[model samples]
Target chain A: MTEGLSEAGLIAVVCEACGAPRTPIGPGDDAALVIAPPRGRQVVTTDALVEGVPLVEGVHFLRAHPPEALGWKALAVNLSDVAAMGARPSAFVLSAAVPEGLPAAWWGAFARGLAACARAAGAALVGGDTVRSPGPLVLNITAWGWTEGDAVLRRDGGRAGDALMVRGNIGRSTLGLLNWLKLAESGWGVDGAVRDDALAAHLRPAPPLDAGPWALAHGASAGMDLSDGLATDLPRLAAACGLVLEVELAALPVDPVCAGLTPDERAAGGEDYGLAVLVPAEHVGAFIARGFASLGAARQPVGGERPGVLWRRHGAPTELAASAFAHFSGG
Target chain B: MTEGLSEAGLIAVVCEACGAPRTPIGPGDDAALVIAPPRGRQVVTTDALVEGVPLVEGVHFLRAHPPEALGWKALAVNLSDVAAMGARPSAFVLSAAVPEGLPAAWWGAFARGLAACARAAGAALVGGDTVRSPGPLVLNITAWGWTEGDAVLRRDGGRAGDALMVRGNIGRSTLGLLNWLKLAESGWGVDGAVRDDALAAHLRPAPPLDAGPWALAHGASAGMDLSDGLATDLPRLAAACGLVLEVELAALPVDPVCAGLTPDERAAGGEDYGLAVLVPAEHVGAFIARGFASLGAARQPVGGERPGVLWRRHGAPTELAASAFAHFSGG
Candidate 1:
């Protein structure tokens, strides 16, 4: 039998271990308080991971991995939104509608996972509400970040001459998801280290959070996370700026772990949690020189902005379709 | 047939109409940005309203009221948390797990109600995420506030003999819930104005957000919202302060709307988003001088704090029971 630590004990443990260094008031009261910025701005965003949908029955989350990984993914997805904005991840609050009668250790592992992710991102789990539900897991997390001065990023600033660039590796999670679900048999013949990593990526994503502010400093005009497939998400930046993206097939970063997959299969894959940006054609050189070096070390001319709806990649034109996870319409 | 607006269009309407006033950056890009405070602190708290649990199918929310009122109550409950901290509500992010195939009009009314409550609280609906669920509505709202310096009020700083004080009316929502549920037949023969007001109180709760900062300014030691009925919640403040509270039963404010109710039921019914405070014997005069007037003029010599587990009120000792809406543990 798992010894169940009450909710109060769980809160106290997390507070002491993942104590905030930046904020003045730390969670003990009805709410937690963060130190307000002087001339800077604060960023906020919210996202949810329902138990059944994203984490299908024995498909994505709960049944496949450790409880800690599920908690990590919960906060990591929201952090991806903060990273999409050119800012430093600061603090977050989690509202969990958990199933009734779970053991104390389960919550301990979950909070530990959240704290580990928060510690890595220089963030703190300030405060949140917990309630019991018969439903599977209805976890909603709201993340915030600090942006210095007026230097914030948006997804609609792409110009007709701007180039669409990815801040990090893509499609690991899509393949990772397939790998986790044991549904992929792509004839890549690459296994061993790469296969395990892809499986791990689906459980815990490492978004290119640092690239956001760096790109903003290096003159990034538009930016967003590549949680949705690039085939759809990149065009969103283009659509926001009233232009089409001309993407080169070979230019998109392909993780060795997800090799031999079709370009559309990977590019249109969801749950990658990577960062995508648009840089003006002239400033592209500067962005490469000063932006992210790890990604730039192996970069290509992925795409450019155009005044048409057709998105060209490789040699063929791809339609600007709805995002991979578009809710109602089955596009 | 109810026409559903596309997610993008709905986002646009919410951004334009429910625009933020306090934050420097409003919702449009990847996230909403708020201007950082110079020397103050930012407060955050989260709460949720499940469809079937808190608001039954044909009772509390969906059946008894308009969509706008439901939206108002959603944000209002979170505002009560900010009020409990003696902080001004600043900004909030809402993550709504709405059912699939809902009409566009539903989202519009919800956003309008959120904006209206935000305007009243001097806060903003900065940003949020909307997802589709086949299940009931699961709305989670996380609110932020700006508190000056280190003036945050907690619920654990009471000394023996400190007077337990309430900021406003109590038991309105509890009785109002009964009125909404058609359970209470404690006939006072009152109709028209009082009847409708009680029902309205349960639908769109107006937390005394003003009393927070006011009480903090006037030498308040401890405070929190009376959300879980005074019987259960006051003991929590007493327990947090390591003392027992002797509340005066007849002195508790009885709403004209909830007339002819038993003292136990009125004071112990939950969902009244009023503020309760603990003021030391010496500073009681100053608290009244600068604190809320409505609670001040009709105040009584409610129970003094004692160093024991026993709490007394209305002549006999009051046993602290779990709130009516205590999620689990069978009440």
Candidate 2:
């Protein structure tokens, strides 16, 4: 039998290990108090991971991987939003709805994971609430960051003729998820290094933290974190800016792990957690020099064409599958 | 057949109805950008409400009450934490996990409730995320507020001789929960007005938002919101300050709806959502004049005594039932 710590003990562990360094008042109070962002602008975003929908398919996601990874993904996803806005993360508050009977060690590792991620981002875990749930674990994280003056980025700031660029791997997380499902269903196997890389991609996504601010400083017009696949997310950026995106499928920097996957499959894969930006055509060379891969360009709508994505394979017009990641649509 | 809104439609509704007023970059972006607290200090807190816990006994609490009320309570509870910290709420981000098939009208009402509460607090609903859940509905709210220059309150700021005081009705929420359960279980009944009041208490808790900052400005030593009942929360304030709390039960401001309840039962109840503070003995009169009720005082331990609470009746030592609301303990 495992000895599980009480809620109070878990709170104590989190406070001791993950307390905000700049916070004047930390956890164990009604609310945590932290120094306000000095820039006079605060970037805020929230995201949640439910137990089984997208992570592990059928099993409890926490049990599928190390609990620390779940904690990392939970906070990292929200941090991706802050990073996408060209802001520097300051603090976060987490509210977890956890079922009873999870081991105390699981919580300890979870806190350490969050602490490690926060430290990497120069952020602090300022406050959290945990409650007993009769359902699967739900982790919701709200992260805030600081943006000075007019440095904040937006997905709708793109102009016609801006080049669409991406930083980080595409479809690796999808490959990872497929491998996990295949292994569980049919004993599918891969090389140890490939398996580890794919699993890490799915479980502990490393968002391109510095790219958004750097791009903003270098004249990128619009940006978003690619949590959903580019197939799904690119259209959203296009629609927000009231333009059509022309994507050159052959130009995509596909990951080696996603080799052999179709271009459509790679483009539609979710959970990539990368950075997608729109930069002026003139800055494309600088962006490429800084490791950004050009995918395509935004264009003015032609002949009343609604905002959408237009994929071009081998420099000709093409059609890709629609995004299949609509929440609550159950499609 | 009832129609349900897709997640996109729901997000549109929330953005239209509850978008932050002070936010320059509102929802629909990767992240929202709002003016940072000008006071240089920020207060942050989070809370969650689940499906089948203390709210409505065994049924889905959301179904038992109006969805609007549940939404109001969810945000209100977090607002209570902000108020307890002597800060003015500025913005909130909500993460909701909803099962498939909840009606569109349910979500509409929920958003309206949230908007009403945000309006009352002079705050804004800045951002949110809605995810599909395979289990119970869980609503987690993270709210933030601004505090200027040394005005924030903490539970550990009490001195030994400070009077323990409370504002707002005690045990009303417990009364509400009991009435809800009794009406469902044995058909035990109450008058229409009483039932309405009790149900409202449990569902839409109007926290004493003005009391905390007022008390802090008026020289209160320490404070916290009475979330988990006096029996549980008072001792927490005492323990934080290395003192023992002495409660005068006969002087408690118990709700009239809980008239027949035992004093111990009233004190042991949960979800009062009121302000509890330690005011200096000299300023107790002013606090009383301003609608606070005297309940007890904090005192130093007499002989190597651990921080705890003592009950007194008729000016003599007595015993009260220990708090029964322990999260994750399943007690």
Docking verdict class for candidate 1: acceptable
Question: Clash pairs of candidate 1?
Answer: A249-A314, B246-B303
TM-score of 2: 0.89
Q: Model 1 chain B, poorest ten-residue lDDT window?
A: B292-301
Off by over 4 Å in 1: A1-24, A53-66, A101-108, A159-161, A183-195, A280-286, A289-310, A313-331, B1-24, B53-66, B101-108, B159-161, B183-195, B280-283, B289-310, B313-331
Per-residue lDDT value at A271 in model 2: 82
* Leading candidate by TM-score: 2
- Model 2 misplacement above 4 A: A1-3, A13-24, A53-62, A105-108, A186-195, A321-331, B1-3, B13-24, B53-62, B186-195, B254-258, B321-331
- iRMS of each prediction in angstroms? 3.4, 2.4
List the TM values for chain B, per candidate.
0.82, 0.89
Predicted candidate 1 versus true structure: per-residue lDDT over B1-331, tens digit per residue: 1246655666665666677543226665678877766776777888866665544322224422456777788888888888788889988887866665667777777778787888888887888776655456678899988777667878876666667778665767766666654533343233323347766677778988988888877777888887777766776776677775566566766468778565556666777788888776677777566543222111223467344334445566666444433421121
Calculate model 2's interface RMSD in Å. 2.4
Candidate 1 lDDT over A231-253, as tens digits, reads: 66765666666765567655666
| Index of the highest-lDDT prediction | 2
